[model samples]
Target: MVPMPEQSPPSATHDVTNQPPPLAPYDASADAALLEGLRREGAGWAEDGVRLLGLRAGGTEAQEWGELANRHEPELRTHDRYGNRVDEVEFHPSWHHLMRTAVAEGLAGTPWAEDRPGAHVARTAGGLVWGHTEAGHGCPISMTYAAVPALRAQPDLAKVYEPLLTSREYEPGLRVPTEKRGLLAGMGMTEKQGGSDVRTNTTVATPTDEPGVYTLRGHKWFTSAPMCDVFLVLAQAPGGLSCFLVPRVLPDGTRNTFRIQRLKDKLGNRSNASSEPEFDRTVAWLVGPEGRGVKTIIEMVNCTRLDCVMSSATLMRKTLVEAGHHTRHRSAFGARLLDQPLMRNVLADLALESEAATTLTLRLAGAADRAVRGDEGERAFRRIATAVGKYWVTKRGPAFTAEALECLGGNG
Candidate 1:
């Protein structure tokens, strides 16, 4: 293994990166009104994320991790499915802090898997929302990110899974978990030829001699969360392409034949786990209707995209939060940064722009709620909203993050 570290000894420096995390039960009741009963079920974890976000450095394991996370946000030379090192990759220690907080607070039940968005859906939809997209804003969509339950049910694969998606790919059996907090991963997608042509994907699903057992064959360009145990794989059936629940390992927790050709790197979401996974006659189970695979996946993907928006919104929020904190205290050219005319103007813009992003994300989430519930509406109308929300939010995301980052400056 070229690079895989689990529970390594803390560095002797003042950096608080290697301390034990703060563990506590998450208070679902407090945020219930805000996130709509997201903590109703699942285990309760201590929610001390704000503390991490508000770090002044030097404190508990949680605090140190937060500071370390911000310091080490960039990727460490790793490849995507196409053998390209993901350069823009960075770490979100604050996010990790929250993940651990969730586990400690009893918000998550799984040992290593933490699905806040899933918990959000399960709680908000009263169990109606079975997929991802939760508390932060809306039903985020990305089949790879949304299909987390598949990971929760399996832990042995966690070692191989988490490492595979890091900014640096682990060599062989070297990947391992360092923090006992929330873990996140991702994959890629496209609708064009040689560009993730989902419709024309050569992948096929054929029934085996045994019933309910199917063999997967063909090349899939993107398989998000390939490192995780559960895979939301899409394959063409007799009708059209659909998703299959392919585990990283078999029922007994053994690595399967599914081959990961390479990991693909990208500009945005650099830290998110992704790859060009290839399943060659791999064994899997058909999740829903044979012909309805793409349709079913669209539902999952729709929710995940919404998730991307939520995450984007949060990133935007955090960027401003850090920026505001710095400008308010730091002085520039013998004057307080915030008092400067130009600085104030920029800060105001950050405020309005971020607020706009948050509002739009919420509205989009509302529309998604209706669509997912199958409420009264013309198909064309829902389709338009889905398309627009997906486009508008994702489109608006980068500018938001960029502006916020600029506002935060060196500290951010």
Candidate 2:
């Protein structure tokens, strides 16, 4: 009553109205360095693919799909309504849309399918573009892409899987590979007992009546993309550690012994499912020769490692674009942040870092193609460059992302 007698209303501030709207219509592949570098490095064949990704990145649909996929993390369904063990991972519709888009865009195994010159470079470029949208889905896409070379070690398996791997469709479910329109491949190598070293892995693979058939008995500490139709798993054989191709559905359409023990609660990559599974006499087909599992899967590992380089470069470029866009709109003091000398220098420095990373990653991608072509120099370069690129680029990624986020100040 005393306050009402003063006849003064409480102060009202429209802070929300004063806030800046989000930046949009950003073409991720329009980076001058990326386009120019791809052209100069003989990967211009991927221009169309990169441009398509640019369009998607700028479009509201793709951005919303990425956001929704992240917002709705995958859920693990170990059983059905009747308590039947299904061991399925359920993802939002957005995740399937993203996966389908990625697969249809040839971001997975198109290079291997086409087998043309500059395939790896083209695929790597496409990967960089697609990876920028949402990184979690890249797991299945990456493993599918990487599995090609390793699958080649077994011609029959390659014959059966290659076509499905390259298909533009993204069929999600636990079904026989022969009945699906498309397929994704997963890998299981790491275990709780041994993270990177497969030497200590104790999962046993017992040979069956069939020459190349075996039964796997052990657990996989990490089986990424559990929804995939097939997994290239490593287990102990009579000849020591070996690689085997394990499928979710058996040949008779019945579910295999593959049991999803639990899904890891990872801090990041929440949109993707990484699970722990126990296998009791899981049916598997031998890949490569006995006792050569490490050597066989090493090809797949190397491919994924190079992908890590491209991914790191892509992350840096994405962060820079976001920061630059924010600075152009936001003002500090009396002038726009973009006009400030210190902020300008910081932005320029970040751009340079991103450009360098892009250049180096694309260069290494080129080296991979040349290495495949039997160029001694490139092969030698790739051997050392892969290790160095993977190490340095990944090492700089976290710091670069942090600095770029800092540019947005409190908004970030």
lDDT of 1 at 25: 20
Once superposed on the true structure, which residue ranges of model 2 sit more than 4 Å away at CA? 1-12, 15-19
Candidate 2: residue 273 Cα off by (Å): 0.7
Q: What is candidate 1's CA lDDT for residue 363?
A: 47
Q: Pick the candidate with the highest lDDT.
A: 2
Model 1, runs deviating above 4 Å? 1-145, 148-196, 266-270, 367-386, 408-412
Q: After aligning candidate 2 to the native by TM-score, how far in Å is the CA of 244 from where it should be?
A: 0.5
The 0-to-1 C-alpha lDDT of every candidate, in the order given, reads 0.46, 0.87
Shift in Å, residue 14, candidate 2: 1.9
For model 2, what is the error of residue 57's alpha carbon versus the real structure, in angstroms, after optimal superposition? 1.9
Against the true structure, candidate 1 reaches a TM-score of 0.60
